[model samples]
Target: MDERSQFLADAAAQRKERELNRVQTETTLKLQALARGYLARKKFVSAVRSTTSEKFSAFVDLEKSEKVLLSNDEVLKWSRLFLRILRLPDDNEVLALLVPDTSYFHWTPSRVISDIISTIPQSLMYISGNRVTENSLFLASNEHKPLISGQALNALFSILFKSVKNDENLLPIFISHVLTCPAIVVHLNKANLDNFLNSELFDRCLTYLRSSPELVESIEPQKTINLLGNVIHLGYLDEETVKNRIVDWTWVIGLVMAQCTEFAVRPGEQSSHNHWHPIFGHYRLPIDPKLWKKLGGGSSSEPTHTAELEKDIPPTLAAIVCQLYMTALSTMTNMKNEIIAGICREDRTLRQLWSYLVRWGNQGRYVSSSSTAPSPLNAALSLMSCPQSLHAAPLMLFADAAAIVISILDEEELYERAVPFALEELVHIARFCNYFCFRAVWTGYVDDRSSDHGLFASIHQLCMVLHVRDSRRSFVNDPKFWLAPDVKSSILMGEFEKKTPRGVLLMRRMSHLVSLKERMLLFRKFVSADKNSNESSATLITGLDEAGIDQDGVFKEFLELTIKKVFDPALNLFHSTAAGVLYPSATSSVHEDHLALFQFVGRILAKAVYEGIVVDVQLAPVLLAAVRFFIQILLDFVVCN
Candidate 1:
């Protein structure tokens, strides 16, 4: 054959190989799903007659029943109830059915259903209770026990787990119930616990874990969190974990955090979100979630220690683990922060030491990714989540994150450094005064639950922080940043009392920066839309905040100065390039508070260029010149670009 022909054939062969590999993978995943359905405790088989269609084929099992329970018209679609059967059993001879509560991504489990049916040529039974609603099954029979023995069940669950790591909810209970063995709730040491990932050790732990299953509607959030924390702690977390688990970790960590978050909110807790329909018109996990903002009220009660964790684990490492959770974790930031602080005491400069956890200096973007991470956010409310131990360094970490942003803006690489983070995260965090020292003279207290804001609490924080941070403290000297309102009379301080002007400004800056920073988070929802476009956003706007500044004369004057000094032209210019990345809600952060937005930036620029560090006296003029120069270059580049 000619060389070109041979090359073409080889290419075709490679393509075929990849397709085959994908099909096989999908087949394996689907079988596991079917197996899980077959093993579910409540699953009942029905025999039906004359069922012949592509989705299902009638199988006659006359031994159990003479009549066919399923027929062609009665083909089954076991989607909803099947979710309860979380894992696939090891026995291949076990015929199965499945119904999954739809997930956002097909990759998780449901993605491969088609592959399984196409390859295995099996029945996709439509189930309603034990009856076959859609497909007629000719066979109907099941034993109380699976054919597999104890060892078989473990190996079966283990192999299925290797393919699917995150779906433990229904499986844990099933394993516990089916095995008639209580799950290993806790072990004595890390060695037996499998902290470091030695497969044999981990296998032992998993075997033990699979055995014990004392089920309860979440009773203790901390108690469950401690037991889980130990398993994660035993693993030697480093570059390898990151490299190997990027795709898997997204689900594993997501599931782990989700479970913890559930415990955090417990069933009836009044959540800080509007979506939570408080059962008795109250709350869930911890004292109505509606009151989450107030629950950890006094300053001293931060959730820092976990009884299950090895106390000897370096505080720095503990801090990194906790700080990664800085954005939100159900409990107020301080409660989380205190835990991190305890760990950070062991090592002060953990950020510098831990490069994997953070992005810095050059590999940064002007906008966060268009996609928002939901697991981390959802876990925020679930009491079952592993909450961050707010050790000391997060405060410092926030400072460092803020400093990096400030320095970059001065140097004109602000877009590069802050784009990836969407500055909104830092700004939202500023209200607490953990990262930046600045604050507005005005009180920055926003109502909690600001509308079931998913991960967007970070966004809400930005708008409110920037809205109030610029005025002199005397403006709101009625109290400070951390001050709790006293309906009856006067108030008192926690940790650091009597807030400062500088503190207020710094707080607001993050508020503003976070808004600009979060522009990139809206893209995921945009992409998630189906081609039919029924559920997508009506508009690209992240959010829109109607002007909430009802103050009369005083705030009006402030608005003018802000527009002239900050908001107009400059914000508008960046918005043109960035608006695509934001949803209306995110954009409304600025729209909500015009004066605060402008003044907050104006003050910071003024201070840095004039009062604070003087990177360049002609910073303003230099910026203008850079803009003009960029315009000229862009004009030329536009022709080609």
Candidate 2:
């Protein structure tokens, strides 16, 4: 019985092996047949090339001789088939026919020919037709899978690279037409894309792009900007490309800043509502597509100038530039010191930065979610009043990136250059701060504060700078604006300029940056006359005990008690770190009047600073750093939570 079983097994194994061999032989034969047919067509085309050229005055006439010339469908089919065959384990027969004896051709057709075929463009057109949505049928199609798979996609990029290499001017066309196509982009796996970006093909494209800004601007610059934005968004840039390849970081920064400022828009060119991208949300510019199209448009009598047209950045492009700038900031964070040194070492970039800030303050307008009540900071800073309210949300994308860059600049740099700029165009920094502060409170949630730390940290930095400077010397002799004399008008008109000390005036202006007008009154307690602040001292009155006048010891005791009560765990106002330093509780917004309490806590800290009292309480390590910008943490934490 064992011997019979062994014989059966041996027979079955031999049968299976023969079937595999037969299949392999058929595949090889099929490949050979395809190669032979392709070779014959190539030879026939070459033989008739001169005859066709002589007979036809135009290429269209030759195209009409369809049988002699490859059709678009045939080109695509043959290209895909050849690519598939090239990736097979044994394609020697196909290689022998296509490659010359002295020449070598690898995976891509670019290796075989100097020109790009119509297949790539045709495939891109087919793919782009579907618009690359989550529900896109093209993404799920099995028939198109081979064309977008690993080897095929690389070949397509290589074809593009070769075409652009043959003619550098073709770079813009490929960027706008080929790379932007959803079909081509959807196939690019991040891992593969990263490798391609590190290649000379990508380097060459970037070199040409950086060589002339006009080259990009002449075409649809937005398309080029979005392409770069997509690359940055993918986080494909490795340390090598970032450190060595990027020639002008300042130019890149300038390009983004240019897109964010305001431009001419006709009065009648209004949209029913402001548009937010369904995908990008509030992290981008709020201008809708209809409005974007109308931006540069004007009446026949009032023709738009080039200077005005330059400022009409498309809404999508504006959003992308914000995202692009933010991503670039994150990628280059490791080189923060280098950025600081660069800005400090050169005044040209510094001056540009200052100018951009001033322009944004003067021209840029944010869409607020609620009433269009002017921000007090706007009046204080002398920013242009924009009465239009077309969007349902506050625009913070530009403000967020600007805050990050400002935070990156060191205190010495800020003191030397930024301080002067801030003083000169008070509206610049005030408008910036107001944009950040006016964002609506994200209430009724337990959340991560990590994403918002950089922005709030920057505000804290600005606060520290203003506070320290004010303590050393007054900002100006006449701090108050004489226009609004009474307290009510001063607060209503956003002047807050009556008897307001410089530090107090700045602080009061910032406090008026709440989203709701009714909420502005909550800060009225802070809006008071410049009293004898030197003689001002706290007296802790204990029930059924003597009132203690705050001498140095009494003040220290009072501060310690106040801080302990404010940060008490049971109160749920603040959370303590491992080292007992206090930070705002992430879930504190669940409590009503949390914002008011935060304002109160801010006053207490300010008083402590005013009295030169160093409290025994420990604060968050970041807040207690060399630069002590600690104002925004409480409000931002509670409201943004």
Candidate 3:
């Protein structure tokens, strides 16, 4: 029985060994097939690389070598190789491959080529570290000139929208590159912009902006706003289209306001003081005697020559832009209060927008002789005067907006139409001037010291505007004109009557000036009495009883606040140990912050004197305090050393 069992076990072991051998044989066959296939693919890829390189090299160096004209099948093969190698292509290799002529073939298989081109932008979105994709797309547009056609632009826009949708951070770079591409601009210039605006791409962009409020405030939106400006300039969209698209108008206004707010205040380091730098001084006119003589001899009268130099000319691109903004403004019916708030906010975006509108309108005035310069101030006033609106709301809203506008105007331009408009419109002017006074005082205490000069200059300009050279024409000569009981009441009790402490001070000053109308009458009498006198006149007092009121008290308080808010912080910074160390070849330990304060205080004092806002006697204490502070800083530095 044992012998029989052993014989069965041997047979079973033999059968199992045979089964293992059969499985091993199948595995070896599969390995052999995979190796053979990989080798075949390697050889094919090598051949494709060598052949494409040779052809592209010949094309790029055609001047040195014969032009290699490939057949359609050969070109198609090259395109297929590019598609396959799209994972990673060498820079020199791809540039040589994507020459102007070779890029033309990319569009032959329209659907396939479009799919391939679309992938590039996606690849750009994903593999941000890769330069090949960006280079490939740029080369296609720049060197190959393939993106000029409507089909190509549409494809590019689709790709851009998709990529930006996926990663919103890429919106600015994508918009900047795509919208400003020379080919795209050229195409849009000649092509119908309305078609592009009406396309799916435009709709997608509108949706994107609507969805992303953060994007509306960023620098990215400027590109879109600029593109729209170009479209309007090119006359692609008519008035109706612009008006009907509330989304587009709101987006643009928000963008403009955002840009304005961002750049409202010039950086302290880049302030106008830098214009006096040695390197930059060459660009400025020298203060030579001859230049002064020439200027003195020039016309002292108003600028009689309008900015328009040519008559019968068509409206300019700037004029069209102005018209577009005006249209947008008209449609901003519900946004009027928001717009006023934006203007009055410290960001100064509204002020910057106002300046841009004026600058563009002025530029347009030069191009189209018949076109009137667009005035943001005028537009806001017109909105205020709109018959459909309640009078009180518009009046208060526009009063604030006008204050911001007036605060930023160039000193020379202050007396132009703005002052005249204020003079003629008594109800609005009273409110406007009241706000202006508040701004003047608030800015003096809160803004940079250099800016105080402008405030003083503006005040001086206002005084000049009110000066009665001709008594018959002077508004001040007529008590009913500016000093009406209703106007005085409105000025005193308006929305901003005592909103700020500084505002209260301003109102007090205004109240005193308005209450003493006899002083204005006396000044008018003195002015008319000595119209021919070349001698400097005496200070015109309102009256002895009123003069006893210490108006300088407000100015003194303002200077004290400036010392506390601006000077003390600077003094503390300057007295720090880090500020005591001198750089090589330095003469003193005084830092720029200290010097800036000195210059700032000097300018304020000088302007105060010039504007007759404060006398030297009143400024003496402020100057003494500044000098004593500087002396203390110097003593600290000396003792530390």
Candidate 4:
């Protein structure tokens, strides 16, 4: 009883202490706010008073006030005062001073407001002049260029870009003010827009972004990207011209892709079970180990600090990155011409984009598996329902951008005009699609899913597109490139992992070792028994005669022999290419039982793949193309219904 009483008392004391700290913190904050407000108001009044020599007491009078007039110098002073005061911390009483209270001053508010708005672009022009003059010192004085000389217009971009690092909403505030100005709307023609884009300030900003990767999402780059987005939105340039300019300015896209690569690649080990989906429970398929290693994934040792760096990325920094990159992609992609071809002409850019896709596509698996992650349902729903929330969490946004570029890369005409994708790149993309699709299926099945179902749809579309294009193009049966055993294996099995029923089979000596027909019949009966059975979660095992247990060697031998015989020219089921790889016979449809024979052989091959057995058989690109068509058809049916 004494121990219980002591425990209750201690808990009560802790709660009282917490309450006291909360009240103290709140009180301190309120005092700080009051002090800041007083200081800002005093500064505004002093600056305003120094601008005029008239009896200001009469100007302050509500009833006895006459019209208060000001000279040009006085109005400029007031404008500068207002702009300076705007830089102070936000306070309602301070902001209220910007509007001339008619009863207090009897002055025209619209005239003053217009003056303040027009002074913004003038300030930017002044800065641009100074920067250009500084740059000209190293060159000939004859090379001097005049600054932007235009009618005064609202250009809050100067204020936005020059804002202190602590000011978070500067761009939004700038947009809000400038968007309401009639001059800005009327000045949306090409020449005026070009001045903004071609300004020395704009050029300097581009240089800064290209050179300083660490600060790519900082004030200057933010201003540059937003400036470009506005110009694009105004439709001042024709689509082709805009696309050409973007191609010339491809480094902006490069910056975005580089940042994405930094954010996506995590250090340390990747678990084999990272793809597990709770909705699908234990039925979720595991990734193939060989394929995982080929992608530069899976377990590895590294300095502990590398993992720490990933966690070090601030939410604010990541949010800025997502916004900037999305804006750039939206602007570039909106153009009618093929921008991706220009952007991905280099291998580095292509790899960066691919890395982005691989990382973000499976982010759901990461989020779901993480203990510190937000609730899967809440996170997924927020991303779908709120654009702002989605912006803050860039996982899906990164995937979507990468998908757009990749879909463009899939266009055959783009390759013909630009550079053909490297062979390994094609293989990697196909492999990733297959694995991504499988994981997507499990996510869709689970109620607490993580990944976007739209990604699955995109992959489905890509598959069909690639298949149709391949059907029209002649197969390049180059034997030298196809000779590497491992490369051929990855190409054939990497694109599609066929689903097969799992069960154990015990075969007598005569049927398993000798006759092809007998082996096929035996395997057919074994697979048929597993159709309605709940044995899919089990590993497939083959048993030989009583003297020898199959462990995996016997099964591998059986698979190799069965596949070789099935694809032989004597069987007339498939034809051999110059590369010595097998392709489905074009006239095989003439045989009544060809389809069934092919299906049976496919099932056996799938089982071999499921068990991680490497058979010597290689499939030609034409056959792989047909496989892609069927897989896409299956996915379309699954996703649609």
Candidate 5:
């Protein structure tokens, strides 16, 4: 209210306003200077681009077709522009593009390209492990050379091995990309890789991959596992280069390493390796008290992570090589479709793709097999890599391998065959279950388990995994059979069948998965008036109680059986019922095929239980095949006779 006080406050306000205005004018002046600098840089870039475009346009030598291919040259132009932005002086990326030509396999790079390359520090671009970039150029889009033509495409990828081996900076990038990039993967996998593999480029990768202080990581080590999966993606290599070098035994001994990738579960121990999933289930492995000390190991007091694992020598990678093939097989399948769909049929990489598949299946783990018999399933997978002429041999062999595993049970007896074979099946089944789990993933029952990063551990995924693992051949729910439950229950199936447990008391957990109506029908068998069907529940119970049983095997078998028999109540309603659809070239959705295939497999299992014969122990699809050229050849000979 006092005039003198108001006047003092107004003068202070005017001083503050003047200071703010003075600051704004200075900032505006600085911004104008910066803008001019940026515009000059932009103008210089435009002039350089115009000059490059004019240079390309002035080429009267281009054929009409060549002009069309190079006319847009968007990818190249942008690549060069980006190279300039990085403050590089010359057109090295373009030169890098020209080098992959088999025609120029002898030709040298442009002097400028060489200079640029030489100037680039290996420290910034090295591909090997234990490295990091000062600036992250690893997945930058500018360096991406999409495989588009014969020599261009070939050189693009062929040089990747070179970049990986010699360009220390590029190695980690390559591995990281292979483990992550969907597009580059689509392209590299597309090439028919036989010839390209072991080419000087690939040979280098093999040499390095095989080199010691190999790539294997400590089990779930503190370091991030983002790149560990790339191992399963590569297809060709000598043992020295691949299996012996990259696998870790602690992880290999079971499902831990198997879980390292995006796959469902470790294909049955791939044992020549290990199972990542907790296959032991409710059955704990009973450590033979004396044997532990005999092995010079744990008295149950030693830390589980003690260095003693070296004594076991770990599961060799060879046993699970087949499973690894399956892992790569899907990648190759994607490449074949996506890459070649845009390019030619006979390009170098596409041709090499053929070879990679053959090698992919057969390579990886003799080290794994020494400790256990080779998996027939693993052997069966080798056909994915074979040349067309040799396909039949592996088919026949895979069939034999599968049958051998199906017939045997005891690991001691299986040491030479059965256990390994079953483990191999487990691997494939694990992959299949993973496939199912992802498809059937209980989404928004939580926020899409698929995006959970840890969805692999979700109940829905684990359940589908266990379901697929325990069942021999499930196509969905159609008639998927549960033989006993595990081998223990499988053995008891005959005795169970003989007594028939009319009231559903014996295997209540499993039968409960079925409806009351279905259980009632099954129960009717026990109380049947026919003498053959009379209740022998007492005999079944007594047999089960006859102590001194193999405890681990019993529990494992029971758990597996419970998994197999427990189906979603709606499983039968989801899949098809038609017999023809079971083997359709391309059936409908996975949900549609689930039941019929499940049921058909269930029927085969029922027969196996009744007759005590191994149900078609082969991995090849030969049994249900409708046509046979070999049979025709045999018939022709018979007619001539």
Candidate 6:
């Protein structure tokens, strides 16, 4: 017996040593990861400050040293470390390193290049002036030019095409960057431009942008507009070659519409007096008489011939402007149908395009005061009537789009129109909360936490709108509506003296109910309910009282349904254990399991009681049943031992 005991003790000690080693190894890895992250961030910040060639060389040396210090496998473990490294000064050498190759263990080349492009500063891409002129619109000043030169850019593009030429995913980021940099476009030699245009790159990029309207917004608005002007100028200068080289004209048309919406100036409104003519005539090309006629200018107007116009603005450029204006008008007329079709066909693009149009229209003079002008709000709201279109849309997308429309209506002071839509959409989202939660957990499309939080926030905002508009009574009459009674009281009693939405209150109520249901289950299986029986019973009654369950049938029904779903199964698990069916051992394993259950139940009950969700007298039976189960488990353990 003594030798047997000694052997068991030796085995236990070996197992404990193994566990300790495992824990130590895990801790070491985590510490190393943290240290690597710190070093990466430090190196990147230092590199960004290195503006001169000598300093940039030093930065490159530091990166090489880091590579030597850490193995490729170690670096791969630090996923976010590479992202920080891309924020370094935008040098071609550094940019080239970011392009994915076989050396990179984890990330693909396309992902690295996309990150590099996205890290380009917004200030670098956008410029501002008191007035919008050709000089202000395009990056004419040396200060506005990115650190990347024309030759370096061409090399980078060549490398990108050669490395990942067929990567459609990387094309949007590439196209957006190219469209935003006027300096790059203007400085590129004809050979490079011809090469890019001739390749399938341009066609693929345009096709991607059209199918994914959201990616269009990713391009800097000002720079893209200027790019449109440049492209049009090029097309006018070499009509036949430009037409053959260009992949699609609709992409060009889309660019024009985006620019017109952003600038909020119609072609005629800005160019009626030929203020843009001087800029175009600078290229010394002959002006087309047909182009002047299209711009609402008479054939007898001054500068009748190309020679009479300013030499600085080319006639070819002027003709391009005229064509762009005509295209903008045609696009504006059809934008409503196009946006609707885009949303229906691709749900992900819904908010991206909608927000760009809505924000531009709101901030600028895009919406005319004339009754004849189309209302973007009316056009967007029409989507709400088509439930089929939104059925498969992500919860976050649907909620955000609805919020934008409501905000626009509120800004326009169209209160009467906002009421029905707000109420209906709020109810629609509430019904889908469970579906969203389920989808987020089981599928990868929706983020588990943010989507639910965002949906609830949207719900609260709409509820507040209805409450303040004195329309809560209508919502209360609807069986589908779900807001706490206390929230209604706060709204009616004017307890919410500020303009706060009752959504916060509603969310709190829901959170409390969920906690109560979870705690009830925990209590039945693990806790010694007799230890705090009186306290638990009192807390349940208080929660029910606060929820106004006595007076509110809907709230009462919700609570009962939740209890049935969560508490009953937990009680069944406890009953089996108490009946000695699941108590296969009276060893430390059984005791440890019971102890863990007790601790879990205790923590939840404490929180529920504190939150006032455990205060209903109707929960007395459930609480007593838990106490009895706890006693039964203790008795079985003692007998088995």
lDDT of 4 by residue, 245-361 (tens): 443234454444333222211223234544422111121234333222333221111111112213433233344444444443433333312443444456466455555544543
Summarize candidate 6's per-residue lDDT along 1-641 as a digit string, tens digits. 69999999999999999999999999999999999999999998556534433433433333554644344355445635765666556655664654433123233233433334433322122222112222332233223453455555555444444433555555554555444445445655576566655665555654665577565555554445445655555455455644554534434554445443443333334343333221222111233332233343111111112231224323233233333333343334334334334444543353343344344324423222344334433222222233122111233243444444433333223333433244454343333342322222223323323333323344334333333222313433543243332233334224223423332332322322123344355445334454465464343443444345456455446554654433333443223233233221223243446557545545554544443354332223223435544112122233334
**Count of clashes in candidate 5:** 54
- For candidate 1, what is the TM-score? 0.24
Choose the strongest candidate by TM-score: 3
* RMSD to the hidden true structure, all candidates: 29.1, 16.4, 23.4, 25.4, 23.6, 30.3
Q: What is the lDDT of residue 560 in candidate 2?
A: 70
lDDT tens digits, residue span 293-412, model 5? 333320011111313322443323442333333222222332322322332222343223323433534454312335433442333332222212122222222222222232323324
Best candidate, lDDT: 2
Error of 2 at 419 (Å): 6.6
Positional deviation of 607 in candidate 3, in angstroms?
21
TM-score of each: 0.24, 0.34, 0.34, 0.28, 0.27, 0.24
Ranking by lDDT: 2, 4, 3, 6, 5, 1
Global CA lDDT of candidate 5, please?
A: 0.35
Using TM-score, rank the candidates from best to worst. 3, 2, 4, 5, 1, 6
- Whole-model lDDT, candidate 4? 0.42
Model 6 misses residue 560 by how many Å?
A: 99
Ten contiguous residues with the weakest lDDT in model 1: 133-142
Query: After TM-score superposition, what is the CA distance of residue 553 in candidate 3 from its true location, in Å?
Result: 35
lDDT by candidate, in order shown: 0.33, 0.43, 0.41, 0.42, 0.35, 0.40
Q: Using alpha carbons, what is the TM-score of model 5?
A: 0.27
Tens-place lDDT digits, model 3, residues 1-641? 69999999999999999999999999999999999999999999779757765555434443455655455466567767877767554655764444332234333243444344444555545545125334434434443345345454444445554455445566545544454332454444222344455444444444555566454445342233344444333234444455555445444443443332232223243444222211112112222232123222200011111122223344343333333333233323234446545545653443443344445334443222244344322322232222122211222333335544443443234444533233444233443343444444444432233323322323323332232221213434455433323334444434233355543444434433344554445445556555547446777555533232665556666655664443333444222234333111122235556556556756765555433454322222223435534212122233334
Per-residue CA lDDT of model 1 for 247-298, tens digit only, reads 3322233233334444333334444652322221222334323223332331
